[model samples]
Target: MAADEPTGTATLRDVARVAGVSPSTASRVLNGGGRAVSDDLSVRVLAVADALGYVSNQAARALRGQRSGVVLLGGDPRTASIAAMGAGMEEAGRERDVAVSITAVGPDAETHLAALRILRGLRPLALVVTSASFVGTDRELILAELEAAHREGANVVFIGEHDYDFPAVRFDDVEIGHLVARHMASLGRSRPAILTSAGHPAMEGRTQGFLEALAAAGYERDAIAVESVEISREGGRTATRRLLERAEKPDMLLAGNDVLAIGAIHEAHEAGLNVPRDIAVSGVDDIPIARDITPPLTTVSLPFMEAGRAALAMALDGDDQADIHLQSRLIIRDSTVPA
Candidate 1:
């Protein structure tokens, strides 16, 4: 090799030499193959491999009929929550020596079908679905793809929805709603209203839980008003404005997520109503911004990052069938406190 050319690409032999281990031992540890190797030896080999910028030869592995260490993630990347989950998955993948590839798909039928087809073609070690729901009315096509992946020895994991038989990592959305509602009720906010995304299964489940808990807390059905909106700040603002126009205004507004809750706060300010005094507001999904906003927003904290990591672990390490349910806690903040 020319002196100007980078020293020949680092190899497994170089990693083994630097770590003082045999090439076979290094291979077993680094490749995650089933070979009895000491934890200390594995750690040393991995450390040396990282320091040397060593990468396994994919072509050679292919020739040896080894499966690629790739995890495929499908979701709408534009959403902040989904984006965060994807980042968490990537971090977990690096730690496990696996590759994660994300594909953004719209909420349309054609896009979802195309994404599923592409996922089937990749035949990755695992497939993670982070979208709210699959494309089209029927889930047959997506379910078929999942079944195909499973038959080929690939794992399938869903983030939110539990429509399929595959393993899933999901938050207890119903419980989240119940917690937030109970909090509102404890504050003596008997008149409550909910603003939520239209046609979202998880959000719908949360709404159902909230209404049930509110009713159990002596809030009559006639006293509650639930509005389905576009799942945005503007939608929340618009819906809250309508609610404010009513003669008997609600004392508490429950938003499906933080974005909507923030919008509700904005509308309250514009209407010359003081939050927590005129109307207390709360939302779900304790996003980063939830804590930064004025009079920090009270909400349900879903372990989204933990869910991402758990999904990866379930896909790569757990049994063929696993169900991981994460908890959501009520985060009490200034927004929900009565003046």
Candidate 2:
């Protein structure tokens, strides 16, 4: 050890000072940059660095590159689709030697933006945002922040529909809706109803496609009832009860997701109405519980995990202009057909 070297763990600054050279010069020698420096000065810096045990900091290396090899995924981790997506991202990250960090963001835009801000401090190489639709000022604010991050060299990728000109991995929500409506029509269901929440752009797209396909099957938009409710099991139950009480009831109920479909089925059983016998029910998102219920639920299976893998691939491959479209398929079960 050098007589003047400090006893504790050494830093680059310490090594530079001991060697009587600028930090930049020491950094060039240590990193083996092509920039020319005196051979004698390089040797002195290397000796000082070795004596001080000054190791390179990964975080500092990232700063020099302007971003780290860490990918930040922002979404609601509790959701099944999000969980699957995280799994896919983690798998791909392991293969690529990149670190994937998942941050839970709230449904509201304010909370979502706050999480994004915190993750930005890490200067991740990519930011993969999987969130629901945002509107009004919230939408503008979110877009602005994302654009700013892009300008700052972070790859911004969205996992859902944003309708904006950005790299995205989107599910074929309209096709999912079309599939459900076509299946119901094949079952000879005439009267149809939509049960979903407002402000969900993807769900809205599904509803629109479902309505269009149903129209082709001889049911007009005015003939079908559409109801917007909170996205919860209780909300589905309450809405189903009200629909059942109407003078003219819908023969088919298409819910936004499986949880609501489960609720609808429960409410129908309480009313002594046999699912698919008196009224048929269906939903999107083929969650695990969808297949384990009394009568399995008929819903669409979205490729969330594939989407996650693709998102990471896009970031790593530097495909910032690519818009990848993933497909969804209908899972047939007894809920929409007679068992």
Task: Point out where model 2 deviates above 4 Å.
Answer: 1-66, 69-75, 133-137
Tens digit per residue, CA lDDT, model 2, 142-195? 888878877888888888877776688888777888898898888877778888
lDDT of model number 1: 0.77
**What is the per-residue lDDT of model 1 for residues 103-213, given as tens digits with 9 covering 90 to 100?**
775566667767767766755777788647563324676678668877887777889866667778878778888888888889876679999875677788789888988
Candidate 2: Cα lDDT at 112: 68
Worst 10 residues of 1 by lDDT: 1-10
Please report the TM-score between candidate 2 and the true structure. Answer: 0.78
